[model samples]
Target: MNKLLVITVLVALLALSAESFRMPRQAEEDQGTLTKITDAVKTYYTDAVNTVSGYVDSVKGLQLEEKAKTLYTDTTNVMSTYAGILQDQLYHIFYHN
Candidate 1:
């Protein structure tokens, strides 16, 4: 009868509404996961850049006089520090970060 058909349609509509509401919760969880991953990547990249910049500044600060002895010593020290920094950064980027 007419009442039976109307009741059936209302039940179907209610089921569809329930499904629609659940979908938004699933979508929000997925979006939050993506945001967390993006933020982690951003933080790693920023730390790597800052560490590299510091190494560059330290090397640039090394100034030796006209004598080759002082220049050689300074260069050796700066090169060792630079190498260590680069190694640490690469390790983080590849393994940790």
Candidate 2:
């Protein structure tokens, strides 16, 4: 009887040890998941606010004009050059050639 009792206790200990090494329990993982969800929601709201403000600025035709000009002038220049080249090529193909 004593030997049987000892065997049962040993089996219980082994089962608990195996469980300790298993995947994270639901409650523990849930806190991390909840924090990630909260951060995502905050990021989404911030982006939404920025978008709405941009639209409001557009109604005044003032979507941060100076900032846009400073940031986009180089890009605009590159695009304009490419467009001019394309136009020249098209003109030659259809009219000049």
Candidate 3:
């Protein structure tokens, strides 16, 4: 009877130790999954920020292009007016002299 009791106690202790080891493995797996989820979220946000920044830069470039075109047109008009005035003055001097 004493031998049977000792055997039973040894079996119970072994089972408890096995369960304790398994719990730690389960916790480690859960922690790994959480880490992966966090990294994915960070990547998604970083991509989103980059996309928005690109769009803003595109819009600014288009605005600058429009301003450049307007300035070019205004400069051309001023040059044409100056040329016309000079031509009129030269024609009057040559004819009236």
RMSD in order of candidates: 24.9, 18.8, 21.8
Q: Weakest 10 consecutive residues, lDDT, candidate 3?
A: 13-22
> What are the Cα lDDT values of the candidates?
0.70, 0.71, 0.75
Could you tell me the C-alpha RMSD of candidate 2 in Å?
18.8
User: Which 10-residue window of candidate 1 scores lowest in summed lDDT?
Assistant: 13-22
The backbone clash count of each candidate, in order, is 0, 0, 0
lDDT of 1 by residue, 30-51 (tens): 5454455555655876999999
Give the per-residue lDDT of model 2 (tens digit) for 24-84. Answer: 6555445554455555655876999999999897866864777678779989999999999
Q: In terms of TM-score, how similar is model 3 to the real structure? A: 0.39
lDDT of 1 at 9: 61
lDDT of 2 at 83: 100
The candidate that achieves the highest TM-score relative to the unseen native structure: 3
lDDT score of residue 58 within candidate 2 = 81
lDDT: which is higher, 2 or 3? 3
Mark the regions of model 1 whose C-alpha exceeds 4 Å error after superposition.
Answer: 1-31, 64-97
